[model samples]
Target: MEVVQTIAELRARIKTYRRNNDQTVGFVPTMGFLHDGHASLLQKARSQSGLVVLSIFVNPLQFGPGEDFERYPRNEEQDLAVAEAAGVDIVFMPSVDEMYPTPTRTTVSVSEVTTRLCGASRPGHFDGVATVVSKLFHMVQPDQAFFGLKDAQQVAVIEQMVQDLNLPVEIVPCPTLREKDGLAMSSRNVYLSVEERQQALVLSQSLQQAKTFIDNNVSGSFTSEELQRLVSKHIQTAPLAVIDYVEVLSYPTLEPFEHSHSITTLIVALAVKFGKTRLIDNLILQVRK
Candidate 1:
């Protein structure tokens, strides 16, 4: 309900909350153009903490040169309504100048774990994510933070960063929220034209096909070369969808599994292009013991 624009003002407000014995604060950091997935995170945060702080900053540091930083959607009024509906107490929407008065020299990087999946495609993306998240963590100093599992790799990267850096906050991973047709909700979904949006369903469909392959006791256990092949086949069915990467990785580590039987928890993450809009979706498959 309350919007704070500057870092100092936001910090002062949080300090006041802490001084008043708020005890637990839940933080959800996001770029604007929020959707149900983001609202889901806020709802979870609100349920767990006395004060829920949602920061909406389109962090330039996390974007690559050719990325859609300029066009990344924004609807502050709508986002505030959504946050209030989700029971957020404070919405911290800081300006770029407030977040970075000068060029940042220090960067946070979680090596090895960040070298694959989304990281492989978006070079230095995780470093940017880690840096901004670290700054937010310090500024908010929340007892808990919420992230969507839709950004599974990002979740892994942040969890690793927090552990390595000894940040005193619990990282909560919320389940991915999906549309009725099965596409994972994303802010970028706004970029999709009607036809492209239809085509984008392939990303989720492909993952579901992979899940079916696993459920059927198909040839391969977890690393069914067949599963990968089938997903590719489904994706190719959508001519407009250009495959970025479709992979099955170990859940938390994100290391690829060569054999299906060897995988305990498999993450089927994919990025694809429908027209010029790049969309991502994934399915987490847990192999039964």
Candidate 2:
């Protein structure tokens, strides 16, 4: 796979493939530190598009104050290997200056969807995400873009942004890949200590408990708040897990509803801190009669 750092070179290479209209381009945008989860995205992109492009930029705009920006993991050598193995045709690994040359004056913001969950906690976080992904989407004008469902909110926000902006790209949301032990795969998983890693299983375990509760209550008697509480209580079982938020909201839309009686789809999303490292996980549930 060919690797290019500048947008000009990346575009020049993509243009070669785009000259043939039958060739569809697939794009996966990521912050470095490639993991199995990232690999899953790349694989999906490879399966769908004639050309797969992976861009790794640890966007500083997405990092909030006092967040793990500087200390966030980075290994270009390993990331490139993963990209090449996944059959990525082009890897756009750009420096911060390359992405944002002279301070970004513009921003892309999506409302309502960004007001709750991760968005509520991290102010301007989705703004950074929307902005960076917007920039990348423009740079790599692919037919489709792949994103993992682990960050369901991110997917929703990006989908909304694309729709609102009338961007010509399909957002393909893939399932969240997990470890054998049930811990949802994340680049941040590397930060967990051995013991903390073991305790982290509760995040997934709690989601399972919530799922069971929903399945058992197919009669739609439970309130959204109750489901949130059930998952929150279960995650608390892990001594080291500090709950950020556990929410049950409409899928894709992410707006909270009073009862499960009317909603056909819902998402159980949560964020928890294991020591200094914060991890997020979720499950999309289909409420059935």
Candidate 3:
């Protein structure tokens, strides 16, 4: 696999691939720390497109003050090896200075979907996500972009931005990858101590309970708030886990919780802090009667 740091070279390479209409291009956007979850996205992209492009840039815009931007994991050698092994054709690793030479006043923001859950917890988080994704989409100009469902809200935000702007690309949502013990895979998992890692299981456990409840109540037996409380209560049982937010929202709309409505799908998600490490996990329940 080839690694290119400058945008001009990356754009030129993609431009060459684009010239051939018969050959479709696929893109996967990610930060540097490579993991199985990221590998899964690259593999999916490889299977769907003739050529795949993976980008590794820990977008500064996405991190809020006091966040882990400065210290978020970074191992380019390992990340590149993982991407190459997953069949990535080209890897775009750009420097922060190269991406944003001068902090200008342009931003790409989406509404409603960015108001709750992770968005609500981290102010301006989704704005950073939407803006960077928009910039990447414009620069790479791929036929399709693959994303994991691990960040359901992030996926939703990007989809909205693409449709609203009429961007010429397809956003493909892939399933979330997890550990053998059911903990959702994340780069931050490295930050967890052995004891805290065990406590982290509370996240997946709570989500699984919510999923089971929803499965049994396909006829719409529970209110949104009721289901949320059930999940929150379960997570709170773990002494080391501090509940960030446990939410149940309408599928794609991510509508605010209120009275129950018979719907086809519901997104159950949560964020919990295991000491200094914060982990997020989500499940999508499709009502089947």
Candidate 4:
């Protein structure tokens, strides 16, 4: 796989690909420190697009004041190997300076969807996400951009942005990959101590319990409040797990639903901090009326 650092070089290479064979491109934007979760995205892109482009830049814009921006794990050597093995054609590893150039004058933000979940606690986080993603989308201009659905809220926000702005590329949402123990895979998982890692399983376990709760209540009598409490209580069982948010909202819209019978799709999402590392996991369920 070819790695290019500058937008000029990256665009020039993509231009060559377009001119030579008109190969449709698939883009996967990531913050590096790749794992099977990232590899799953790359594989998805490779299976669909003629050329796969993966960009690894830990976006500082998305990090909050106390968040792990500087300490975020990064291993470019391993990331490149993972990308190549997954059939990535181009890897864009731009410096933050190259991406920002000057202090950014503009940013992208989607409202309502950004008002809850991770967005609520990590203020301005989604704005940073939308801003950087918009920049990458314009730079790559791929036929499709692939993203993992581990951050389903992020996916919803981006999809809303693309629809409202009429961006040309398709946004493909892939499933969240998980470890055998059921913890959702994350780059931050590196920060978990052995005990904390064991505790982190509660995030996914709570999600599973939420799913079962909904399944057993096919009568559709439960409210979002009840579901939230169900998940929150389960996570609390892990003493090390600190609840960030437990929400049961309408699927892509992310609006709260009063009764299970009202919505066709429900998303049960969680963000819990285990010691210093915060982890998120979610399940999307199709409610039967």
Candidate 5:
């Protein structure tokens, strides 16, 4: 894969791709520590577009105070190998200096969609996410951009941003890839201890339980409050896992869940911290009347 660090070089290459090559370009932006979830996104992009561009930049803008910014994790060699193996035509790896030589004055923020769940737990988190993703969208200028649904809220925020700003790129969200044991694949999973890793399954388990509750409650007997408590209680069963936030929001808009009295789609999500590692997992379910 062709790797470029500077924005100018990357833009020049993209220009060449657009002018000379008639192939459609797909972009997958990610942090350095890639896993199966990321690979799934790359594979989706590769299948849909003729040329796939993968970006590996750990944006400091998105990380908050006491968050894992410095010790997030990085193995450039391994990431490159994985990207190439996944059929990435170009890999953009820019340093902090290259991405932000001067302090960034402009920042993108999506309201309501980012106001709850992980957004409330980590203030300015979505701002950083939106800013960097907006920058990447502008930089790559791909026909389509791919993201995993594991970050359902992030997907909502980005989609809103794209629509509000009228960006031409199509935002394609791929399904979340899970571990054989049920844990959602994450870059931070490496931070977990053997015991903590097992404890992390509660996130996914709670999601499944939420689905079961929806399946059983045909009359819409359970409220969002009950679902939140159910998930929080489930996570608490694992002492190592501390609940950050447990919420069931209306899908897409992410409005606070009020009633399940009828057929509706709800996004059941949770953010839990096992020691210093904060992990997020979610499930989307349809309720029938």
Candidate 6:
């Protein structure tokens, strides 16, 4: 339950904790506006490490010029309560001024994998994500870090970044937490109007439909283009669900499948606009006999 604002203070606190040989640190880096999905990450981090550190900073670098950077949710007091309840040992809630004292000229960018799905639409979004995540990894210096699979591509990107940079921390991926209706839990869920929210169920429902297709052997012969059309058709049926991208690709590599390979796992990932709020969800299927 200690809140450390500056990096120097955080380093000192971590130094004190490291002096004890038995302690292992776990870090969860997030933008504020806490939700159960974020809580799941914190709980996982708490369970795995001797001390859990949660950092809440809505990084401005990650947002494109027209994105919701200015309007992104923030409830510091509530976030602190949620983190404390989830057994976070240290809450590193740094201000933008503290994180970027001057303008940042250097940026961390990942290639190939950054050009698809959410990346294709948002433009420079993953670069911002990669840069900030690298900064957090440096700032926290934890043995293990937790991330939710809700952003599956993000998890893949961070894994690649860690491998490329040889960062000492392990990137732990947690499953996406969903609502009773199957919509993935996100802070942006608040932006959905009641009507838009209801229509949003199509995102997950279509994934379920795709899963059913796979489960029943109907998807075995479905080409990637056909699969994308199938999911897109279902999503568009709901007037409120505007398709951003519906793609089927190799699981972790995220390369599009030229043909449905028997040995490769398929990722059915999609992003849809429910009114103005963009929601994303995916289904991972192993092609097996």
Give all candidates' CA lDDT scores: 0.89, 0.92, 0.89, 0.92, 0.90, 0.89
Off by over 4 Å in 3: none
Our tally of clashes for model 4 stands at 0
lDDT of 3 by residue, 159-234 (tens): 9999999999999999999999999999999999999998888888888988788767757667888888899998
**Which pairs, if any, clash in model 5?**
none
Question: Tens digit of lDDT per residue, candidate 2, span 154-234?
Answer: 999999999999999999999999999899998899999999999999999989998889778757677899998889888
Candidate 5 regions with alpha-carbon error over 4 angstroms:
none
Per-model TM values vs. the true structure: 0.97, 0.98, 0.96, 0.98, 0.97, 0.97
User: Would you list the clashing residue pairs of candidate 3?
Assistant: none
Candidate 1 wrong stretches, greater than 4 Å: 218-224
Global local distance difference test of model 1: 0.89
lDDT of 2 at 184: 93
Best by TM-score: 4
Write the residue-wise lDDT of candidate 1 on 88-181 in tens digits. 9989998999999999999999998887788999998899999999999999999999999999999999999999999999999999999999
Tens-digit lDDT track of model 4 for 1-289: 8999999999999998988876689999999999999999999999999989999999999999999999999998999899989999999999999999899989898999988899999999999999999999999999999999998999999999999999999999999999999989999999999999998888888889888887787586788999899889888999898888888999988998899878899999888998888898999988877
- Ten contiguous residues minimizing lDDT sum, candidate 2: 214-223
Residue 107, model 2: lDDT of: 91
Candidate 5 global CA lDDT score: 0.90
